[model samples]
Target: MEGAVISDEQVDLLLADTLEQYGYDFTGYSRASLKRRILRLFTLDKALSFAEFRYRINNDSSYFKRFVEQITVNVTEMFRDPMFFKTLREEVLPKLGTYPFIRVWVAGCSTGEEAYSIAIILKELNLLEKSLIYATDINPAVLDRAAQSIFALSYMKQYSENYILSGGTKEFSGYYTANYSLAKFNDDLKKKIIFSTHNLVSDRSFNEFQLILCRNVLIYFDRELQHKVFGLFDDSLEELGYLALGTKETINFSPFLKKYKRLGTEKIWRKIQK
Candidate 1:
């Protein structure tokens, strides 16, 4: 039977229970999106009622993990919105080269595609040796998949196209090897990355960074949470550091709006030097 419609109050209760039991907070996410994802869980499981769904989530830790993964939204591709990476290559990376070393944080780095993209850029610029990339996501499952650096072979065609459009000089296929259904990226590219499970909702900044990319992540958050996260990014970045957001995200409504200066047409922003 199709699951009975889950009410907003029930979803809120689930979010609260998730926070209390798992310590993962989703309180600040957009209500509509949260509702959709939660409803999807019910539909996928053929859950008959909200009570059953809640009971399953509460009793089965593994089920809860899957549920968390479902709601987190791991949609991403390498060099997505190619112009953004193009701008990073042309404008941002050159300026960053002045620094003796570079630290980058790719928050919500699902499946490590974007992090790998950045590492490829650094490699091209001969900066990989002096760079450290911390790629984090709230879902441990995604992190595990990301650390494997093995993506579907089907994606390579699109990724290669993105690479070419993003101003890549070398053959994009050179970076990875295809093994049947999977494509494994070069081990050398993986060396500089550190993958970890990080809860951005409740976590504090652990280190300063010269470049922080949290693209497509803020849109899921409500205004108040977006502001809070912007403040966190502002605190985490070095003066004159770069912040990159998703194509659809903007800094106009942020409390820290004036603190960042947009660079060209790309979603790249720079912290104004004091």
Candidate 2:
């Protein structure tokens, strides 16, 4: 009981069971990452046995929800990788500004920090009135928190510094009001955002967007799944639209390589072909 180990076969069984019972397809995710997260959750929950863990995940809806949340990556912060945001502010958003109405999609948006960050940029650029930001994630629990527009007050200082590095001139604290332990962002920033549940593994693209940000999410996927997601993004992006990824991700060797042109050294690419 001290050092419980989940076998490879058991992992496969759990993955298959999850798909069949909950319609969530984790089959294409990287096995190592998935297994590690699953084991961590198993230990964190202190499950009596693997069988009990499996049973609870398969039968109890609430526990299944928690299982999905725990396994999927949710780590995010506003203005993460400040240089990336700086590029978005200086190079990307201006070009997008010419469009009459801009549609931005933040896939795997986690708790919506990225989406909120984009909204702040749009507002500052005087484009918020004509923009719509769709922020999506696989887990509804995170979406619920995201919709609240409230974040831990403690992280504000770091986020503020990131904002400054990202070329923000205004006081970052102006965006939110401190309420003891929590910081509630202004309603104006959340007005243009629509938070919803979207599973990149199984969900089809719902709209064509001028800009799509799926940072730090693709690394957890296998090559095949990454290809599938690239195809989904291609279909969902408008002509000449931009796709941004995490610092560690790229479009190299993918079938869509010839279709996109990299933007400088940043992990952003613009679609140049149909």
Candidate 3:
């Protein structure tokens, strides 16, 4: 309904039903952000009230998948916040070189662009051979797209610009070949990356990592959930390992605040030695 006033109780009921029926947890997400997304979903059909939408969510298995997709934000890009990548190249990668092998975890990697960007940087720095990247997200749809490694050809211009700004030494086009409407990234880059589905809200850390990039994904979460995920990251990182967050996120208020030391001006943090 165009003018339907969905109550807070309705949203809570919907989230609770989603968790109970589908086992997907959205209870820890920021209320306002979740509300906006849910309203946006409701606007997709003006005929359905919030209760009807909630019923559809509980009744239709297929629509449940779409509902999950709707609420989860997938906005991301290659070398997003170019300067952050630049710092990663200049400051972080060099330190990681001391390790014989490196493991990088890109959490909530939507549509694969972030993973591809990291692979490219590692390749440029001659570290790809020794690196294993685990790129994960909760959305199966985006994970498939990421595994395909084919982005819209139109996005190349912006991705290329981001690449250059992120200290790309060679022509950005060298990394991918363009078909008529899609740009296929090099298979070599994809080989070093593993794409999987990981639900940050409910899943535990699978492996220790030398670097964890959970960029831009935490902003959707409220403080309690943010701390939970931060704890997961704390456990996931090896001693002196790096943790990168979104530009707007910080470890300041986190319980693990003292466990990490901020690095330079980037949103990067280094795990403090015990």
Candidate 4:
């Protein structure tokens, strides 16, 4: 027979107590979802019971990094939800391009897929050299991986399909080369991006952006924290700049509702002209 699972109450104790000790603030996360992820964490680390896991998380940096990875393992792919990129290239980029120079922030850019996706589009639009991309993620481990600009070979097929759907005309293979099991991206495409560790949980707004893409990241945060992040984005976006959220995410329910309009059906929004 298999081992029994941990209880949700125990999982709460694990998360809440660990948060109290580390000051990482999981208190704002959705309780039910957090419990689910913690249960999965326990399953993945079957050698460690909840108590032992909590102990390691509090006392060891290495354990904490692994814990963060478990908690924030989101799915991503290049040109994902291609209509979003279509909306970007059609409705958003034109306005952004009107500026002499552009600054775009890709908040929570996991594993560099989204960042690279954006760079490819900008390159196609001839804005690559004139624009600055700040691709930030809370996980330093993911940041390091993003900096390398290599992706698993298995993902190439899916990325190529997405690129095509998003109006790509070039051979996707032309942008990368195979090295053993990985596909290394072209050096020219990597030059315009800056990958850094930025905690959306604790970090303050550091710069203004003409376009901000914080896709799918808000689903992990509670409503209050989502609004807080929206405020940060609103402040960071310039007059008439663009904002793109995840497929299901939106600014409609928040105070930003009146201050933005959907750029298209594609999850892109522009700041109100006021």
Candidate 5:
């Protein structure tokens, strides 16, 4: 099945139907990215026609769940971008530790790897007891897996290397117990973390935070949508709070740019003005 089989009109129709019926808005998502994922799902599911694909997504609740999961990108790993975590450990977390209670929002935290990574940092810094991490994603299926505190054991070697590169001094294996093919992370690492569903497209800011990490998420949104989400993050972040983005993302063109000061060469910016 060629990707061209799914026409632009068909993609638009599917997005509209998804938003109307499920309240999951992908309308602001990058058309090329969305179309690509939709086409992939269409092929993988072996749908005979666009009509069958649309019908399954709209009428079957289970299929709709699968559609949401498939469309939304969920690729993530612990301590992704080691230097980012290294900066957090050496600079960001220290400043945040001064606060009586630290509140961190890991938006678009797919399957919880990054959330756990943050928890590990807080724990090592002795700030875990004083901190709360809200890990959220638009897809509930991923959120469910995140809440389980389990990840593929096969990825540990890479994750452990990332941890070491990120200035971790302890044995990375101490963080989780291997159970056959899966590794169950320590329950303590999740004690201060909360996993929930949040749609950046339509959800309102639920709380103000000292740090908000929405890395690699906005790249999937159109410029207009990216600005809207930046506004959402702006409203949810307290004065002097920090916002982190993926290496490919930046706030240079955002209306909020002047209000923030970039931190070093990393894609982190500290809010300098309320």
Candidate 6:
């Protein structure tokens, strides 16, 4: 553990070599976030020093996959931020109705919570039939879980309250049925969503979208990465489409600050004409 101190030079060297060799770009991520995750590698595994861990990960595909999952920032909950969903319900959805068909890209959707939340809202608006949701994440494990749309039963009570606070119309129970320890989400809701592997740092844009929801995921990245990904979102979204971020995030500091119209403090921003 003593030799595992991940210095800035080590971080730089590791990240640069990683991108050059594997095309996984951690170089553009926040130094603090990078430090924390790297430190965890040392603390969790007694066999590894900074250089040793880098050497091991460079050769081991399984180790690198674990690193990808660890670094991708998968923390999320169903209707986690009530106001964001409330804003979507009250403001964003109504304006979005003009489009006969809507395609939403939920970038960095973790464990299916946010995607399910959006699906619930679209269902309430009678918009699910016309909607196609592409939910993506760097963590394949989380994406697999998301695809299953089954969550632990223990978390449902909290999520039910969140659903209610986010302006749910029917009994929150109407969305999912309980088995003893798991809640399998509605099959109808599952049909509208397509969950896949997407690396915001390395992957190229797949399609232009009517809305892009990239929330707390960016908080783990440095400003350069943030701006680069923002540009990606800018290119991916259709003209005047919406970009919904996490409650603490904003485009004000990014290059797209002027390119987007901030709908409100609820973290909904409308991408306008560039």
How well does candidate 3 match the true structure in TM-score terms? 0.97
Instruction: List, residue by residue over 1-274, the lDDT tens digit for candidate 3.
Output: 5566777898999988988997889999989989988888888766356667888899998888788788899999899999999999999988998899999999999898999999999998899999999999998888998999899999999999999998887999998999999899999999999999999999999999999999889999999999999999999999999999999999999989888899999999999874
Write down the TM-score for model 4.
0.93
Assess each prediction's global lDDT (C-alpha) against the native: 0.92, 0.95, 0.91, 0.85, 0.95, 0.86
lDDT of 2 by residue, 105-207 (tens): 9999999999999999898889999999999999999999999999999999999999999999999999999999999999999989999998898999999
Worst 10 residues of 2 by lDDT: 1-10
Off by over 4 Å in 3: none
lDDT (tens digit, per residue) of candidate 6 on 52-157: 7888778887888777777667788999889889899889887887899989999999898999999999999999999999999878888988999899999989
lDDT for predicted candidate 4 compared with the true structure: 0.85
Candidate 5: residue 87 lDDT (0-100): 99
Question: Which residue segments of model 4 deviate by more than 4 Å?
Answer: 1-4, 17-21
Estimate, for each residue in 1-274, the C-alpha lDDT of model 4 and write its tens digit: 1464768677677767666876566666777777777777777777456677777777888878888777775678999999888878777787788799989999999899999998888888998889989999887788888999999999999999999999888899988999999999998889989998777766789898999999999988899989988988988898788899998898888988898888657788888764
Better of 2 and 6 by TM-score: 2
**Candidate rank order under TM-score:** 2, 5, 1, 3, 6, 4
Q: Write the per-residue lDDT of candidate 1 for residues 96-189, one digit (tens) a residue.
A: 9899999999999989999999999999999899999999999999999999999999999999999999999899989999999999999999
Sliding window of 10 residues with minimal summed lDDT for model 6 = 41-50
> How does model 1 fare in lDDT?
0.92
